[model samples]
Target: MKSLNLYIFLLLATLLGTSCENDGDRVVLSGFQEAELKATATNVVLSNENSGKLVFSLMWDAGQLQNTYSERYGISATALTTTLQFSTQNTFSEVKEVVETSSSKSYTGKALNSLALSLGLETGKAATIFIRLKSSIAANTQSLFSNVIELTVTPYEEIAFLYMPGDLSGGWDKYTTKVCSRAGNGEYEGFVEAAQWNNFKFTTEMSSTSGITYGSSPTDLYALDDSKDQWNIWFEEGGYFLIKANTNAMKWSKTAITGFYVTGEFNGWNPTVNAMTYDSAKKLWTVTCNITTTLYGIQILANGDWAMAYGDDNKNGELTLGGANIVINEPGTYTITMDLSNPEKYTYTIK
Candidate 1:
């Protein structure tokens, strides 16, 4: 029994010594080593090959790290984040960082264009782009940067307008020409008024006779055969209409508005109190009401609500939202006519 107890005590002492040694000894984890990154191409050129769109691709090799630190630190080398640092100068003074999260080394040129615009680079001008790559290893360590590459990109000119030069309102003049705004997907829209025997056509320029001109056909759209062959779209009777044209599908549509109203201080600012009647033959909203002598403003309200309301911006017949009130200094019977069919030339007459 004495020998057995002595053996048990020795075993306990050995175990305690082993535990103390382990407590004093620190287990160090290996960290990531510097990686050498190389790009497949040193320079890239971006062009508007695909309908004013350019795509950029970068192929690279990330060097091996020492000690398998990724596995030790619960990280994957493949999962490391990659980012592109872009700048106009080689010194990288105004650097913009764009992350490339995809496994593939591809980026769209549109992104580079946006960056260029942000950097004050003008469109249609060639600009040098300096770019470098950053690869992250661990959270605590610094990221590795690849060699810089220079790229030359020429952004395309963005065109966004279609003009209507017609004799509907008057002769083909700048004041009578209607400007149509682009609505994306090769579509343009605007409002125009037409009278019987009036002729008008779509043109790229307001005053010039050059460039593309659209004319009416039995089909959706057609090019004018010659300068004299301006096939104008006409209306049997004079009326106001909204016009929408799709250049891609070669189609057009028109919508006629039936009514609108004047509701404001003259009518207690109540939309439903008094309404204006539309004269289909005249293509105008006409109303004559008694107004108070007190200072009051009027607004044109459509469908008796604030959702669609127009006020005079300069009180000079031109209508726009958030405009100055149309005030009547003296109370009397007044005649008001609103012509809203032509968005480019909206007017309200007071008498």
Candidate 2:
């Protein structure tokens, strides 16, 4: 009985010893022997034309730790987290965690372009970035790092947009659905007319299969959360509203609006005089204006205010938020069409 007890005690001690500093079986990463990082591409250029294509991939050797030979990759395989960081300087003065808890990290042209621009990298210009991997059981200890990799990538200019579709957006399949254009940095704004103010949510894309979907938080009504399935944003009643979304702040607001108006040099900038007519079938705002005189610069105003306004910045028919006023060259009663239907592209037409 004594020998049997002694054997069990020795077995436990051997197991405990094996759980710590190891000869090979359960080696606790000391954060000294660094991991090896491999990159698929070290140099490339990013453009909206190739935004969907994979730009590059960075992978690291996780050694036996990834194999999960034992529980507790420090504490356990589940506790080990790998983070991929981005930095412009080798010193990593400013670092951003691009990926987490992954052995490999990949970026597409769009993803990399957005990240580079968010990091203050100039568009269409070559810029160098450094990437490093960090594997740690916790924030303060047992961390393993990989050698840094350098990349030279050039990103392009692409204005981000958000899509809002619901009962108000012309049955959800029509091209006439109103779009919330990029108003400012991380901000979006649009004018929507809801007959019943039913269900609606924000999407990064028009489709349902992929892209991000943002909706009202389950806990807070005004706050927004990023989820594929979440609470649909609601309104108290059905009416015209100026919808605003700030992705950076993760909040959305719907301001009740009366209607849209055509305010320009022709009306002496009087927003209230020329009320634009809403065509329910076409889901657009239209007005037949008699420009007996030369009308230079016309702007579409929401709720008779500049809070949400659209004009042709380049005078090329396409509308822009707070853009330069649109000019009318021909003099006569002409139909001005304001189309806010397609997302990512808004335009106006003068007939």
Candidate 3:
């Protein structure tokens, strides 16, 4: 009996010493819990609705993990049939190094399932994380912790120009409005066009869910042409256009174009061409082109001065600069009139 008791005491001491040696030199810490993670939405688009860029950050009892990984924590987002999985590597030690070392793995990509991070006994190993919403996971539901995250994206621009006439009938009577991504993932009901490029002679109307109506510019889609070969083949459903090139330089008007003196003289014709007019109700621009040649083409110009002000003669509302800016020294009701006498002219009020 004395010998048996002595043996048991020696065994216990040996086991305790072994455990201390293994755990003393090395300490492992779990990365972070879902509640500590944060995600934010940067941007989104309607045409490309389901996909967007998201940025997330992690914070936890980093302790030794930060120094173990050679690279900044690596992040990778893996896609499953219907979801995304985030995977992480805790700490990777170099095989050659005697001193403890660590390597890190991160998550990136279009996150669509479950995400797992290596932790606990899995230290210095890879971990596949299961991402589940707090509402779905009973472990996370009652706990005051967040296991999964979601956020809605906002767009860079609230409103964008989608349509300008690309191909038109000889009379300029029928046209298609070009399409682009809308702001806030909203719908674009309708658009207007100018008689010609560079001339701001078009009208536009748009309304939000609030039932408030707003005027827009006759955006120019002149740059879209086969000559440059930048855009895809003209697609009606996709809102693309094929444009012409090398047309006579003419002065554009709200309803007409003129001053083709050089081309007119070369072709033994008059210098002035008829103005082009866009019938909003008809959604068409009609013009008479007497001097004929295939050299005529349209270039898409940038939207300038169109989005700023509107016909806010009374400064009671936000002044969108459809016309010019006014210097109002005194505050009161000011009558600003646009030059309607000539459809080709621009007019507005300052006060």
Candidate 4:
């Protein structure tokens, strides 16, 4: 009995010593539970009727490194972030991610439908989307990924656009409104065919009275005036022209390009021959020609004359006035395109 008691005492001492082995100033990752993402509904059909209503709400825990290990050892952790990922493809071939500091995110019917459509889902068709959460500390170490959740959603059709109507059609006819497209830099560009007058203005919608109208200010035709009483911008000459509004610089320019034609070996270097057709919608000139020579020269001239000529000097798909002849390799049929949208830079595409 004495020997057995002595043995038990030694065993208890050994266990106690082993427990205090890691009780020093060392910090280690003992264990952690990844952030789990949840949603209010796994299946929903977004509708226009319920456009204002909430479709679903996503909830996830804020990532913070405050585990028992941090408490055991005095150590401060940097800011942690949680990002939510959304993808229509099951394999997540393309993903749209949103970083959220809030614990919950809610989407309305219209918002969800727009998101679904933007993610390549068809309208009125049910498709599944994958969503998950990724959490990591400032160190970007020990990244924790949550389980992916699938949501089947049916979306509605919705399109947002701005159409400009002006007096280039002789009157304020919404039917003849010249559709203007805004670039990413807030500049508006469009084509207008004027017959005998150049009085024009931009409208925010198809109908002028229903939406906002932008017109000339007291400064000049280029300046914009934001008011109910707006003046129409006008000029003397009337022709097919391009109107560019630079809101950033508070200026505008009107350029007229009558026509473009190909003058090259294909047409015996005749500027008036092989008239290229102008694509009004795309604002480009395109032409197809047959080349009998493997190496030849081609030039794009204006007004069926050599008043303004462009050529590819370095064969780098760029145009320079009176540049070198463009070399053609391998005789075959090809389509050529001229892009003079930017007055400063001119480019061409041959395929």
Top model number, TM-score: 2
- Most accurate candidate by lDDT: 2
Cα lDDT of all candidates, in order?
0.57, 0.68, 0.25, 0.65
Q: Model 4: residues >4 Å from true position, as ranges?
A: 1-23, 29-32, 67-78, 138-142, 161-351
Q: What are the per-model C-alpha RMSD values against the true structure?
A: 20.8, 8.5, 24.0, 19.6
**How many clashes in candidate 2?**
2
TM-score of 3: 0.19
Across 1-351, the per-residue lDDT of candidate 1 in tens digits comes to 333443443354455546657667322223333323344443434444543343565665544433322233232334355667778899987676645544335444544444454455656778887877777654544677777777776654333345666676466664354544322233556656666666676654454533345667643233232123335765555665666765434455665644466666656788766678877557677888888743767877766657657788786888774567776668888998877555445788889
Candidate 4 residue 178 C-alpha distance from true site, Å: 17
For TM-score, candidate 2 versus 4, the one ahead is 2
Write model 2 residue lDDT over 1-351, tens digit each, in one string: 333443443355457558644655543233234668999988888876888887888888755333233344222344455667678889988776533445676666765665566456776789998988866554444577789999998877667666666665555542234444342245677666675547777766666543456778898878876642368887778876667777656788888867778876667888888888878668688888876656465788878888778788787889876988778776678888887655556788899
Task: Assess every candidate by TM-score.
Answer: 0.37, 0.63, 0.19, 0.40
Error of 1 at 109 (Å): 26
Per-prediction count of colliding residue pairs?
A: 1, 2, 44, 0
Model 1 spans with C-alpha error above 4 angstroms = 1-177, 180-190, 193-201, 206-209, 212-239, 243-256, 277-284, 339-343
lDDT of 4 by residue, 168-221 (tens): 554666535443322223355654556555576765445654433567776676
